[model samples]
Target chain A: MSEYQLPAQFEEFSQARKEGFLRAKAIKDSGGHIAGTFCTFTPCELMDAAGVHPVSLCGMSPEPIPAAEKDLPKNLCPLIKSSYGFAVSDTCPYTYFSDLIVGETTCDGKKKMYELLGRMKDVYILQLPQGIDRSYALEMWTKELHRFKAALEEKFNVTITDQALREAAELRNQLRQARTALMELQKLDPPPFTGLGLYKLLDGLGFSFDLHSNLKKLTDLTAQLQADYAAGARPVPPGQKRILVTGCPIGGVLEKTVKVVEENGGVVVCFENCGGIKPTRYLVDTQAEDIMSAIAQRYLNIGCAVMTPNSQRMELLPQLVEEFRVDGILEIELQTCHPYTVERYEIKKLAHDMGVPFLALDTDYSQSDVGQLTTRIAAFIEML
Target chain B: MPVYSIGVDIGSTCAKLAVVEDGRTLVHQMVMPTGWSSAETAQAIYDQLERQGYCPDSSPCVATGYGRLNVPYAQKTVTEITCHAKGAAFLFGTEACAIIDIGGQDTKVIAMADGVVQDFLMNDKCSAGTGRFLEIMANTLCVDPGTLCELARRGSGVSISSMCTVFAESEVISLIGSGTAKEDIAYGIVESIVNKVASQYGKLSVPGDRCYLTGGLCESPYILESLSRTLGLTVTSHPLARYAGAIGAALTAHGLARSERRTSV
Candidate 1:
């Protein structure tokens, strides 16, 4: 149990990705559990909650998913082809690290992707609905929780008892509070918090941590900040206009973009992104019928037009706009993320139509190239 | 009463839309993001168009792109290849021209004779030579597209093998960490992108009066020079060539305008 399982050959993330290529070169060359996941952008916290190490999974190459191709239509998104490319080529990373493959209905392709990978040893899908309804969200999240618990229990031969839930809940609550505090800090005039700090806080918000003190410490920090914030000691940065940022995961340089706004006297009030909200918002209620449902419900709180894209968000954004009195809108679109790009278009027009200044910044997902965002964000603030 | 035609190019990365009034370019252009639902894409395209005085209520529209299926209000949808050829013909006369269009999501090499498509090869699977590729390389090199191209022009050393953004980004990082010259990597990177492009674009099959380059990558001189050098062909480009697709769509509208006038006459 204590022995290191690092492959003698595979090293680094790319090596790990290509290990299947090596393994597939000859069937008898390697023997171990193989798994494939969609991509690195989505890091399922639930897998960590179950004490399972989750890795970003993809198929062998960007080739079409052969099995689904005939039925899925030729013009289907390239992402689908890449998904099918995993199993059909057998050089899929999922072929190695996965004893049981779990898929989410994030997209139509991924939702139906499991059927194409039917050759996989055991495929477990946590059936997710198309849209995000609050009640349904709760139910869905809870179902995932129970299912994950069952799977983890079976895999590890250990029970995910109520105590574990409470413990995990408390720790997660600490992370959530930290995130909420960071959101509050962004409201500070001159913008004290950066996207990098928020990213760091959310980096592990979904997992179960055994340390009670760690969460309590963060909770204390938030409480202190709240008290300080209430006393009006930390005034909203002087002359700064408040704005709500809506986008997918801010690639590497989101900090630069935020800085651009801050430098121009605009403070970011809330971050509406899958990366920004998913980790901080996905805190499961320990007492629920299904923990996964609670997680999904919490996920909905971030107001993603995806995950759940109806009334709650429509109401929430306007409310946030009014409550925060945000002067403008900045929608950052990572080049590859079509979902956010589409959404930004809607948000931009809505913002402009409503007389709120709207601007969109499209960039790649690398960290250091953030200066471009800084310039545009600063310009946006200036215009506002 | 004067007539108006709205043309939309539902590009891979962005939707380029233009409005023409009475066969004259009103030039109501929109560059909006794309993806998500077809409804969402159409809504976005329409909403952006609204900003330019062309609303669903006011003007007739045409749509084109890989995502033409998403544009709701279009009277018709045409391929960008056809649109680019039409646009190119209007710009450089409808003689013989080979179209090299590097859009956000896809790269297309089109042969046009008499302002129409003869044949074409498109590379859409991986965005190696497209606008997306430029964005990625720019991000990797920590520069804007203009600067990234300039850096590539400085040195012709090094080699980039992978076309995958995920892998290529890592490769660039590792190379940089190992003290590879920034410009050399940039040169190699652009070269590699153009190489992937050439692989997909089987051969430059055309009756070459002139090989006209248009689309997003038309702005990347480094890529253009590298492609031309690799394929041993001289390329021609014009200012505002990014508008080729939109211009082409407008040209098609102009053709429609003429046909309708003849019927009225």
Candidate 2:
């Protein structure tokens, strides 16, 4: 048998998981016997601390979900079907690993989904009480936060002092600042970081950020990236627009469409890859009177992937364009990627209305379409 | 001649067409599969329209279903929940109805208040409790929707222990191999389907009297016969059931078109 390998770090799938996982682990890993707290988010962080890795289980085998169709509405997205299928088949590995499956009330689908799946004994839900903009909402979240913290304390019998959270916050701040620097660096003449390299560095943020020595080591690593660059000492080709695309890589086609833009004489600086945003954008003041409230304020208020009443994807477009001072935003679209496709439609309408001419490129992010996207991107840049 | 309304339901297995005149369905039919090509699917629909000798282009066409977006010529895309509720209310003439629609891909349980959707839960991830589930069960039993419904109506008092299609198929296969009655197994399959519907409807505060089911699953007499079992009250099945979504869309379009003409006048 191969030697058992340990993963470098543990990560929550979404921001919600980050908060909930930390809550559970902060108490549990301290080795206390308190019952676990429930949040709407899954238990990635808590699991990691418990020496369990939480994988975001998205798809299903289609075997069990077909039966659930009788019990569920037809208009629901496929994601929920898989959730039910997972439960019906007992297919979720995390089911054994997870002490608590916390869920946020983001939509009607997730709420119903959790409720339906709550047939299992241990999974708990920390619903985001209604009245999103109300003070009561804030109070509710704060109370939930405290309750969650207490549950962690009770479960693991660990006393997480305010000081620890402050330390966590400071570490998070450093990571974010480094990310901010990386963002600024993208504006340089030839652009400093490739989207792929930027995503990898951002991915390395969450685990090491909690440990100061590790974070210091990371800071040294980021510093030496400059040396690595200096060592290579190669310039980008002339007459090419050093543009970074700030778009979510949705379909498998993101790379294909990206190649298209590159061929079109534009170089992609970043994808605003969710991986880049999550670890690098931890903006909460963990030292506040209510750490949970601070975290919520940081996450909900930000125009990131989870903070959506509107697809603030376009918001990233402008920032990346001006920072990178991109010649134009080549909005690569997958014909069926509903979220981005709709966002592209609005972006196009707004571009036309505002006279901010940006190219909207549509192709099934197929590798075959790489040459086509590159050609179009080259033309859009030349037009500018 | 008065201006009329129409509803179009794009289901997984079929494209259902419904023509509503004065909030009532005059004609309804289900077309075949939406082929691999969108244009081919659209053309098949177009040909069906020409065969029926109706000009869908002349009317305001509101489409509903998983393939609602794929309906190239739809004027608007209304969710299946809204369309189902409208169809149920139009068919049953009831203001408050619990509309359970079991199509091929998913099952949706919707609570309708005066032909408007109050809340809904969709089972987009499963083939259980849906028309597709029935298709599988029927294949196991060697029957179609028409014969399966008849068998379900004719039989009673059997339980389908499994919900997983894979296991259920095996169970049915084993039962047939063992010498279990075909009617009993069919009844069991239909009952399990009803149980699945019951699980979804259990979430909503569905009223006892006004519960109706639409879509191909309802085409099974055995399933509806099993559904006749009470959920604190009686559940009724309508004849125009499966075609309800398309009828609602057509009716909605017809009404909208009439209002537009009235404003112009």
Candidate 3:
């Protein structure tokens, strides 16, 4: 066992998460399968129904990035490098226990990295259309979703019935509802919890996989928050501005930037990134006659940079700002992530049109730029 | 009764102390090398003030810069970005302006409007466009940085190839060994520093008309002239440009003191 222990509040969830990896390993030892995924584009519903545990493991540390130097360029996205590094170095237990690794064509860097990852592990790549606005894109993605379902069924030797799929979608919906309740507490002026607190809580959801228990914990935490607020207690101190961070996922790997914002006297009330507020932002429409199409539609509507002409993302930003009562918007772009970097101009313009102050910071996972990041964030807060 | 405030800016290379009264009149400003201990240097400055019958300890004290938190006596610690913006606004009026500050270790280009910091960009990791970069190049050239600019004024067009401080230092050594004129090399070094700074300044969305320059490098006339010729904007600097951050912290101290007094009242 690792010598390190988590904070007291996170103990229950952390313990449950640690036990999950062991249980999944035990099941794999008994001839069961565990599937590892990268992006959210991989449908977890299908895998969950096939009696296979689907785990989203986006590599977050820079420790393994140098190991990837032999094959990949030095300037590739740190997220992909860290994930590939973990796999190559046999550092990630989830990737090791995974019978199959599922990947998506989210960005160019990830697309090529998947091809290289295939040589090291059993891998399946799902193709996603770049432009969601095109008429054929929806039909194309639906077909891809069907192929994903078939691939899981064929590999695991179990048929996923419509009832099983519906049940999986229902479980995911419960997780989303729980997450929404947690994010809603941030709307309070002096929120009951700090932004870092909510970020950690949401980050735990991806790894823990114990949905029912995690939901209970989230519900209990929110209840405690309500009671605290009722008794005139506030977690965020006075003079702290509410900040909304939107950009590529920090992936719970490198939180240097978020910690800088918090430490410099600002509260990050909401996150629009894949890792932050996005995972629980939407629920699958199980009521649709064709449940597969429903799943495809819900996930595709996600405001990911992978989607070309992503106006829906722009449409969603102002609403999030209003809902979260955000004071300022910070747009962070990971170094060399072309899709998000290309969208920088539009995002800034959107923030301007909405009458909110916006700061665009391009940074990486390295600790080298921490001071610079702190100065910029502190200045942004001073403006608000 | 006249209330006083003290602001200390413990920068990477130098520590500055400013004393202000009623948030307007600047009573005194002092600058000294930060050396090994910035907090001790700051405390020494306060001790000197106390010896001169100025009770700085009773006043609201504020600190800024990399070593801000080190000053145990400070009631509050603010970032240099905010302090710089406040200082620039005090010097120039409350107009929309951009302040380009080149410190020993970090270079900052901060935007301000209506006496508030709007946005800022800092290059702390890169030493190419900073005061430390020039210090290294000057030491290698065997010329004092204060006198290097005067020497550069006598020479005409010669270009330095590298922007990296270490590489530039080696290039200077090579140029000296190859019988290149020291004056021309000095001019080339100034040009290289200007070019490095201009590239980062170009990233700012602010207009050039309102650009104000601060920091230790502003003390060199030839370098400032080169910057003007390169950027085509008559960049202006305050007579007390080096004390801007300290003055900003002093202003913050004054405001905090008044607020606390009001709440107590």
True contacts kept of each: 0.00, 0.00, 0.45
Window of ten residues with lowest summed lDDT in model 3 chain A: A2-11
Compute DockQ for each candidate against the true complex: 0.02, 0.01, 0.40
Q: Residue by residue across B211-237, what tens digits does model 3's lDDT show?
A: 888888767777778888888887788
| B-chain TM-score of model 2 | 0.85
Candidate 3 - CAPRI tier? acceptable
Model 2 chain A worst lDDT window (10 residues):
A32-41
The TM-scores that each candidate's chain B achieves against the reference are 0.84, 0.85, 0.92
Q: Write the per-residue lDDT of candidate 3 for residues A286-305, one digit (tens) a residue.
A: 88899888888878878888
DockQ: which candidate is best?
Answer: 3
Residue A117, candidate 1: alpha-carbon lDDT:
66
lDDT of 1 by residue, A1-384 (tens): 322243443454476456544543332223323233453222244544555444434432334346545555555444455556544544444344355666765655556667766664566666555565545655665566577668766875656655555555655566666666656566555445444455545443322123355466666656776677676664454667777877645534455576556555666777765555334644556677755555555544545544546444455556557655678877766544556666765675577566776667665433434433443454345345
Error of 3 at A340 (Å): 2.2
- Shift in Å, residue A181, candidate 3: 2.5
Task: Quantify all predictions' global Cα lDDT against the true fold.
Answer: 0.60, 0.57, 0.80
Candidate 3 Cα errors over 4 Å, as ranges: A1-23, A252-255, B258-265
Runs of candidate 2 exceeding 4 Å displacement: A1-384, B22-39, B51-53, B153-158, B217-221, B230-232, B255-265
Candidate 2 per-residue lDDT, tens place, B64-181, comes to 7656666666676665666777778878888787878887766778776655665555542346777788888898888886677677665666676777788888888988898887
Give the interface-residue alpha carbon RMSD of model 2: 19.2
